[model samples]
Target: MIRFDTVSESTLMVHLADEIDVSMTPLIARLVGQIQADFPEQLIDLLPSYTSILIHFHPDKITERVLRERVQHCYQQWQNKPCSTQGKLIELPVFYHPDVGPDLTALAASQAMSVDEVIALHSGATYTVCAIGFAPGFAFLASVDEAIATPRHAEPRLRVAAGSVGIANQQTAVYPAQSPGGWQIIGNCPKPLFNPHQEPMTPFQVGDQVRFQPIDRQTFHSLGGEIWPHWK
Candidate 1:
């Protein structure tokens, strides 16, 4: 069932599901495309999360009541059409070590596993890009291996470097740019995730598949990765 809630005079949030499930990615992706195709003139923007989409529309172009009706119709048409989850698969090279990822040693200790074990567990699985928010190109990739899953820090760091890969509960993500954050840092990806001047802007999109490939320190530097200053 889909529920529509008023966010503002021009914004309506569409709740597709109550929980965050990876299966919902395809629905959310398709719905975004459908709404854009169906009402491009009236839509200002759309922000998708794990279970909902924040829709911004032009109030002058479409009334709240009518817009809701149109969106619901679009949802109904695409809801059961066998959408594919096989979006683009992007491989990210990560340097999993202590210098860039300050919490690596502590996180390993907490799980009673060696740092290499933690790294392997993290890099072994293919994850889905469920949502993108917090910053441009900051993608929320889902379901870190259960053995290596860890909680966010009780206190967020004042600044987390760009490309820092971290885990909070079942989700893992790379800090697309340097920003204050709290997710447990495990490694750093050398790829520059967001480039405003670039065509796609971000390498990640909702429903895309991501796999972290381990790399050594020298390779990390060669790829243009900066060493995050060690926390005092």
Candidate 2:
């Protein structure tokens, strides 16, 4: 069941489900595409999260009543059509070393697993991009293997470098820029995930598939990844 709530005069929140479900990704993508195609004039922005979508629109162009009606029509149309669960596959290379990932050794020790075992488990499975938040272009990927899953640090770090790969509970993500964070650092990716000058800005979308490729220190630096001062 879909529920709609008015956030403000020109904003609407569409509640798709009560809990986070990986299956909702493709459905959310389909619904967003449909709405964007149908309401090009009135929509200012649309933000999709784990279980809801927040829509901002032009009040002058369309009233709340009319907009809700139009959105409902689009939702119904999406429901009637077939939705694909697959999204674009993205393979990200990471240097999983103690020099870059400070928490890598500790996490492996806590789990009673060897460093190589932890790395294998993390890079073995393909994960789905469930949501993008915490920072621009930071994608929240879901379901790391249970054996290697770890909790976030009790206190967040003062600054985590750009391209830092981390895991918290069952979710994993990469820090697109240097910022304060609490996720357990396990690796660092070399790719630049966010570029302000780029058209898309982010390579990841909510439904995209992500696979982490483990690499050596040489490849990491060769790809423009810098080891921060503390890690060195």
Candidate 3:
């Protein structure tokens, strides 16, 4: 719990009571907004480890002494309010075959598992998008099953085709574009995850639920569904 009190003309204090994760982010957002709305002059400094909140403000607008009083007011508001955690779920189809997952054998060997075992484990779980980074549509799906935990190739591939699904550090990610990466390749999804020409170029966002459905080679080529035929 964050406590509020008068301190100085340019500083306010915010505090936290627990670990910061995807679930608690909403609460933090609410707090951040509250401080910004009430004390527009203050800068919010959040410490996730100790769950401490510090408010640094301009001495000219609200004095350091009144800052404490303002913080107290905001803290009470936060306590009485609720944080939201609503999100959407998405399922993408992935094609995992020898051609696409050339390194599957290598990866399977590294983990001492058969190729089929690797695919089953990879596609069996509901993954949460921990974060969207490293590339335009690249997402860090939360930890994969412990059974298939493996490392990326020692030598990062020069160019990995777009839609390539790779695993690293217990998480699986789809390469939205043709980019060089070291994550162990296991599959590919034909769906266009990113298209700058279309509206909302990005498909997935942070915290979205994503599940990969596996398909074979023949289906992969057949389902390469034609892009909107503007001329034909």
Candidate 4:
């Protein structure tokens, strides 16, 4: 079931589902596309999260009743259409070593698995880009392998470097910029996930697939990846 509420005079919140699943991402994306196509002049911006979409509209251009009706029509259209399996598969190069992954040793020990086993489980799974939040270009990828799923730190780091990959429960994500975070640090991805100057500021979008490719410290340095000195 879907629900709608007015977050503000210009913002409307559309709840498509109660849970966060990869299957639901495409539906949300399609709805966003429909809204953009149908009401180009009225839509100021649309923000899609794990289970809901927040739409910012020009109130002067669209009435509340019209907005609700249009959204409902789009939702119905999304439901009647077949799901599209096609999505971009992005491979991220990650360097997993004790020097960068502070929680690696402890997480492995807790799971009764070797560091290599942990890395294999994490890198092996193809995660879905469920939502982008917490920071700009911070793609929240879902369903990390159960065997390696770990909880976040009781105490978050004062500063987690950009491109640091971390796991908290069933989700995994990379820090787009230096910020305080609590997710268990597992590895570091050398590729910049976000750059304001770049054409596609974030490499990921809703419903995209992500795979982590492991590399060594030497390769990481060659790729211009640097570990924050504060971590050392």
Best by TM-score: 4
Model 3 misplaced stretches (Cα beyond 4 Å): 1-85, 225-232
TM-scores, all models, native as reference: 0.93, 0.93, 0.65, 0.94
User: Against the true structure, candidate 3 has what lDDT?
Assistant: 0.68
- Of the two candidates 3 and 4, the one with more favorable TM-score, higher being better, is 4
Please say which candidate is ahead in lDDT: 2 or 3. 2
Comparing 1 and 3 on TM-score, the stronger one: 1
For 60-149, candidate 2 gives per-residue lDDT tens digits of 987878767876776776765777765799999999998889999999999999999999999998898888888999999987888988
lDDT of 3 by residue, 174-204 (tens): 8898878888877788888988898768776
What are the runs in model 2 whose C-alpha is more than 4 Å off?
Answer: 74-82
Clashing pairs in 1: none
Model 1 Cα displacement at 50 (Å)? 0.8
Cα lDDT tens digits, model 1, 121-155, are 99999999999999999999998888888999998
TM-score of 3: 0.65
lDDT of 4 by residue, 1-232 (tens): 7899989999999998887777888888777777888889988988888899999999999977787898788788667677774569999999988788888999999999999999999999999888888888999998898898888888889999888999999999999889999999988998888888988899888878899999999999999889777873
Candidate 1's displacement at residue 208, Å, is 1.0
Better of 2 and 3 by TM-score: 2
Q: Which ranges of candidate 4 are over 4 A from the true structure?
A: 80-82
